[model samples]
Target: MQVKTDFNEKQIQILLIAEKLFAENGFEGTSIRTIAKEADINIAMVSYYFGSKEKLLEALIVYRTSDLKIQMENLSVENLDPIEKIDKLIELYINRIRCNKGIYRILHFEFSSEEMEEKMKILNDVRDRNLKSIETIIHEGQAKGIFRKDVNIPLISPTIMGTFFHFSMNKAYFKKLLKLDTDEAFENYIQTTFKTHIQQTIKALLIYES
Candidate 1:
């Protein structure tokens, strides 16, 4: 006898199709019928499982956000230096976007959606949590005279994040601009350019403090 899996496959199928549809079409553009058609399920099953379209979208966002939170948690920052922490954050952000192309694409595409006003509120909370972690590391480094105390925590946090964002945001353009299609070339770009920018920024901010 075969043992049954925990999550219902039918529910999983609904979620998978819904995620892709919402990603491709903004939340307002997606509909229950479209999701049902995409999932090859009865239209009524959509309402039965998710209650409403809004709830379905919320579920999809929560699922993706959970994955991101898990990835953020996996980086061991307790014993690392400020610069290393920044590097780890960078690596994590890049890898997260690279690995989950669908989610990142959806996020970028929906960056300015009207629905995002509410979503941004949730993101701000997550960003605040992540920023606090980074802020603590910066403070520790400042105490050790390794990082400049004058550096703006808010500015620094977003600046460090901007590198990964820019890379992923303009991935297609950069890929063509550099004419480097291979993975080795991309790794070199991340290491040489991306890493250099981060290290140099830190050094510039910290090295001159008395």
Candidate 2:
């Protein structure tokens, strides 16, 4: 996605290589030289673009979520009701997870707690913006008398996110346990059954009670 603007072709190439490397080798394990060599660019070029390996990893996270921000922005202006927007938001995550499972895998598994705070420091702006975007939608629903004011976005956001995340992070075990026959069947389950479950849970959590 959005990944900020004005990135040149070479910068984009290095970022893509860094994403694949970071996903394969964990953040601490990946090196600047490794990315430079893999991308067939000079070490100085990598530094010129991203400064440090840590910064490059931060860029990767930004690159992945750029389009997501765009999608959310688009949805904000649509004529859909707040409830419909919530469903659309849920669909956006599920669909993105289905299509780019590895990106999600990289995001979920690559961060160790010690450096998570540091790395998130780099990503905090994007993270906070996305959270506030969701929170704004919730407040709109509350004003419309559709969503419960008691619902907490911080808890509810992670709940919705974690449901998909936990499942994806352990999808192999989940598929085997559920006796799914093939990858296609497993994907179908996620897109339909799991997606529906997530939608229902969010709806239940936010629905105004009498």
Candidate 3:
């Protein structure tokens, strides 16, 4: 089943609460009752909205990631050059992950569990769609003779995502090492220093050397 696009106020509220709880306590640890209580709704309401915890988790993934498709579609049609499109893609990815770290963490957890193959299918499908979008950008650059011909297009996403994931996973250590005093300071570093670094790295990969 696809993720529902239109969520009412209450459904969105429940989804947000479920996302937070799943990220904090995990699917096994977070019960329907806990979600209901956290959302200040009854368990029946939770059941009515999502039949089970698994369904809720699936819905959460859909709710969180469904917008990426639309965003990517919009970016593809923009009047920007391929390089500028790539830069915008980086910015979009970074901002999206920064805002929804919790849901991503849950996705990571679900990905590693064999019992969650159905959920994994949903996540993998979304990933493939996103990768195709990224590939389109790279192909556009290649067609224009801007990007190198021998580029390993598949590795590009991991390079961008892996670097950010590594930093975020160890953000506390990095923050202390960088002498950042507050969350705002660290985030500023990410949006500026880290983002530019990703853009530079990708440009280096895609650009041909004379």
Candidate 4:
């Protein structure tokens, strides 16, 4: 599927409702009628726009990731230093997790389902491209002698992805433990502490002395 230029109001509304429903209920558990009622649209409209429940889910994934190619291009922008590029990436990952919060859950849900294999292919390709973008930053740093030559991209990449995912996915536990009951308090923690931590960890790994 093509990366959309942008979605119109109705398309966005349906996708958002689907995202929330899929987050609360598993994909198979949610129904088109439920989405239509919640979204206040006709069932035929949903089918007309997305063709099937599977395509609607695919569209949801695409809507979220439509800017990936642009982000991929950002990795090569000469205006940003290698470290700045890494910061951009860290910011991207953390903020996306922070804002949507449901994206990774839906992604993981697909991974654990046999019915989701075809859908997984599209996401997997996007992931491989993003990984290559990170490797390009490392290569740039190494070229400039700023980053260590022995640094491992594959293993270290997980440090960024895993930590960001873990914190967001487990935020309810964190909120209870930290006693951040309000939305403002929890978001402040993510926008401030959680973001800084990812940036610091990635930088430390990049510049670690051999």
Candidate 5:
């Protein structure tokens, strides 16, 4: 599905509010009225902007994921080595999810609902495109003899995403375990320590061991 790229400030505000509601309440549980009320607008304005809850969900997904697609496209054209490309990809994915935790949370919650089959298709399509981009980078590495020939391309994305998702979902527990008292400190750990660990994990999976 083609996503609308241009949005006004009011439209973006509505989308952000909807994303937060959807993450906390799930798509089926969130109503247009609720979103409108949260955004301090009338239901008619919500209807005018998105027409319906389903379309709003689609717009939210598109708004959240389109930039990542663009970033991946840009990364594909860079002159970096395959290993460097993978590292950059890891950084991009982590940073994107960190910044947009609400939308990602919505995705995780609504992805398996039987009522959201159509919306899940949109999400799956975006995921497939990203996985294909990662696969391309791995193929480049293998072709250059920089990575192992026996790599399982399909598992790579899940490995990176799943690890982060597990950590993020249980962050409160981990925060106390690690003695991270402030949000800034936890974010610092993610960008530095957690990010480096993921990069190294992917490197170990892809790189050739002589």
Candidate 6:
């Protein structure tokens, strides 16, 4: 069966080019005409498909976040022990940044905008559901006696995210700190550290390693 998607070739190209431009330049720096030219499409087509320049930016943000949500959704810890689950979380975190470097750049660079405050409010409306998913996984691990019941998930969830957050959020600083350029080397550091830290975190939590 053939499935229909929201965008056809041209619209997707518009979005792809817009995202790159938006990431390179701030919202104020990018313009609809510029995006149309970059996409090699008619300026009227950009408006026809996306409504307005602001709507196009909103669409780009949605596209980025929805992609992250899909990746998070695809993750499974159903049969894995808590120790393994933690390791999986680490792997997912590092792998996500690796795969979505451009989106990560957008999140890192644009999240501070005043316009994004309202958009973040909308995304925050789903915060409970997202946090609960993490809490449930943590509690399940505890119930199985593979994780510390005393562990504070409220603390841990943010902590795990912080690990990835710092690596991504402070990427420019780290590029200089580590004397590295490009996302690939940054990813290598993450992969190396995740292996070390995940092993240690799980060992400390579970007490016995198998």
| Residue-level error in angstroms, candidate 5, position 115 | 4.8
Window of ten residues with lowest summed lDDT in model 4: 113-122
What candidate 4 gets wrong by more than 4 Å, as runs, is 1-6, 155-157, 179-181
Clash count (model 2, backbone only): 3
* Candidate 1 lDDT over residue span 132-180, tens digit each: 7667767767888787768777776556556666875676788889886
Per-candidate clashes, comma-separated? 0, 3, 0, 0, 0, 0
* Models, CA RMSD each: 5.6, 2.7, 1.6, 2.5, 1.7, 4.9
Model 3 residue 204 lDDT score: 92
- lDDT of candidate 5 vs native? 0.88
lDDT of 2 by residue, 139-199 (tens): 8899999999898787766787688888877878999999998889888998888988998
Per-residue CA lDDT of model 3 for 65-155, tens digit only, reads 8898899878877888999999999999999989999998777664676767654567777888888888888888999999998989888
| Pairs clashing within candidate 6 | none
Instruction: Give every collision pair in model 5.
Output: none
TM-score of 1: 0.71
Leading candidate by lDDT: 5
Give residue 157's error in model 3 in angstroms: 2.2
Every model's TM-score: 0.71, 0.88, 0.92, 0.85, 0.92, 0.70
Position 139, candidate 4: lDDT: 93
What candidate 2 gets wrong by more than 4 Å, as runs, is 1-4, 110-115
